[model samples]
Target: MLSTAARQAHILAKSRVPAANFGLAARRFASSQVQNEASKEDKATAVPSPEDLAKASHLPHISNVEMPNKDINLKNKLEKPDYEKEGYQVPEWKKAFGETFVSLFHIDMDNVRAGTIGGSKYYYMCKDQGLQFTDEELSETAVFWYDTLGLPRTFAMWFQITTLHVWLLFVRMRAMPFKMGKNYQQKLVDKLFKDIEMRLSEEMNVLSGQIRDSYMKDFHSQMLGMIFSLDEAFAQKSDDVLAAAVWRNVFNGDKNIDIVKLEAVVRYIRMQLYVLDSISDRAFGFGDFEFVGPNETVDLLTAEDKAQLLKMTKMKFEPEDGKTLPSQKSKLSLDE
Candidate 1:
């Protein structure tokens, strides 16, 4: 029976009779079957809208995916950028900027390694673009390594380097508080941070992990020992003890920092105070006597005190009458 139908179909290859057009008739038959199946499916399923049809047309074509509404794609935007096509570039100036910024904050992230050229460096390159620090940064509260050097890409890097620097300084000052006391140790601390700045200026462009790798060298070990020693002391302290030690002054005061990352956070605040002090010194050229040791004492002068200090330094004295002074001096006791 099958052979008989095949023979009949083969006879239709002559194209003489209406059903003899084998190729054309087969195409018509296939079209009718497709239409019948499509009709059955349409009956079973609801009608698809124009949008759904358009999406289906593009389903397998990954090259041209439509922007699936903002609300749905929010996750993609918040996450990392599409570097494959968008191209994550590390401009020379931006790299230079990171080097300079890290120099100021005391870390040479350029030399640090996050894996590949396009890996960590590229990640940091983008992060450094729109990086933002926490509230502590705006308040100039602590060391502010995040705001200063974290570079949005590697949030941990800035904290790690800055925290290490501060922890070491803290250790040096801690033992000295008993031996040399706060006044002496603090000044030394200031000099230490200053030297860290010099270190940054010297090697701010090194890759990530690069510094940590070479940190076992003689000089690196010395510095690393200082940093480690400070960390160990802090670690030895009870949580409550550590918090109270570094944060007592700033805690529950007119100024308070978010205490999530207590140790590193506290250091961040201190770094900020150091920066503000630098700014003040720059704004007003101080005499050598006014510039004391780093931790010795901040001219934690109030705004009014700062103005008074600046004015006094200018040798601008006013007599009782506020008149012009003589070549030598003006006596406040002079009559109007």
Candidate 2:
């Protein structure tokens, strides 16, 4: 039996499909060859060890964060913020000028990720963690889901893991002020499906548009169901409830799942929400939110630190002379 590290390396190598770059004619030819290679590799690989079955974030690669004591209930650790009550106001000047600038340049601050190369900033935030990985690279968050949690590296598994992160972000976005939050959610969802479609065609080699459309429909339904369950758990504001939701969806109801691993996931979700809650509307609107690493900790921001951050933001966006070009004109505040 291979060690956890060796197993991951072997699995990644065997399953690693070369990114599709060939024309339609070439891709049709390469698909069978790729499948044959995968089959050969499958026959050559060894089964995972019993230790692997028992493990979840038990290894050093999983995270530096220590697991909770068996007696400790994670329910007390979860924090749910009331975004409606705590929501910040968007200034009229900012809206009027921001809209004018957007009309001229076709940039919507509310959905700035749409302006990004591959979709919204939020898309990358959700993706980089787990959904997207290559033969040569596995993201830190990917390690957490795949290595730490001992999940299979199939496309369906990827979707399950990615959906969990996306749902967590949705929690934050839904808590945001209505109009802006809705726009952000729509843009992120649009980009997510767009990428999924592309991957189905290019990465998964589903050349049939009809088949891909069916998969999309199925995925859309799953996404909605996952969101509904997660939202209900979140509303309940109990870590145990949230963990059960994670177990049902992300872990796929694995009866053998380690309780410590479940607790880690719950802890991770709460930490992310806490960070999102800490961010201001202006900062997040401008694409400032990032997932903290599973092994890392975020210190509470002090009043002086926030003041300095705002000062720096203003220096970067606003000019000293106050004479801005029409294309560059923006009334979005550096401080919100």
Candidate 3:
């Protein structure tokens, strides 16, 4: 068998073909309350119980799905937000104060937790099946990883899958303007380590913080290497190079790797990148993008469709007579 480096080199050499051949089309919260003005009012209402208080507030949905084959409603449940954007009803004075503060401080509050929220919610979608499903009821991408590729269902394998998807996002982020791109990358990486640490403790049963930290360091190193390798392949604009990178990093360089499955994965990656390239930087930064289902095909948007999207986005963010809060104001364009 060829050495690992030699194998990678061979794959890259074979990938001298332009990337175009790979079919890279272009394209919350809340509530509470309390009672009373005086003893008469308090006696009349009796300080609403905790249950009553909870019933009064419309809390956001939080997923409780954990085990395999048990998350029958995972897709449907994920469509709801963890925190609602409306219903906060800040006072006009406070809104004005916030607007002043934001202007004075020059804070871009619009994207404040974009990375934290977006990464935690969406990036996990890349390999969520391992956590949500077992071998019995796998998702489309899960089937590709576990059934088609015959990879073991272990945390290591899951990391490989998640990392591959993360790298695909990185490609799109790299195309973004530098400051925004850097912030998104940093926040996403921060969230990744945070989640990994939790998984290592809970799932892997590391028990000891020192040991978990050591494992984290190792994974961090591995991620850096994968990013570098994938970045190089993307720069080369060669599907072959991309395939080689996926083979080495995602498929673990399995000598028995199924070439057909590998090609499908390459196609999947290309398809995702095309969708990412087609989105506006504002839409992505604000956490508006979702990964296309593994089996879904994305038809290129026509000029009319693009125009309609811009119109809808503007209506959502900048309604003509709507009372958009200053905190919600964003300089990002809807048309872009």
Tens digits of per-residue lDDT for model 1, 1-336 = 011111211111211111111122222432343343234543344322212222233112112121112232433433444433336786788767765676566542212221222232223222232222332122221213223221122323332333444443233233321432243334433443443343333334324445634532433445454455445435553334444543432221213343443443333323222322322211211111111111211112245633444444333334456553222131111110
Q: How high is the CA lDDT of each candidate model? A: 0.30, 0.57, 0.57
Residue 257's lDDT in candidate 2? 71
**Candidate 3 minimal-lDDT segment of 10 residues:** 24-33
Cα lDDT tens digits for candidate 3, 31-51: 001121235543463322212
Residue pairs whose backbone atoms clash in candidate 2 = 113-120, 113-121
Number of the candidate with higher TM-score, 1 or 2: 2
Model 3: per-residue Cα lDDT at residue 57: 38
TM-score each candidate.
Answer: 0.18, 0.62, 0.66
How close to the true structure is residue 68 of candidate 1, measured as C-alpha lDDT?
A: 19
TM-score, cand. 1: 0.18
lDDT tens readout by residue for model 2, 1-336:
111211112212332232221222222333434564445665365322222323533533322222212112322221112221225566788867866877777764444532441145567667657653344356766766777677666677777777777886676666556665676677778878987897777666688999999999999998898888888777766666778888888877878777777766765666566555544444555555566566543333346744555565555456799865444443333344
Q: Residue-pair clashes per candidate, as listed?
A: 26, 2, 2
280: Cα error in model 3, Å: 0.9
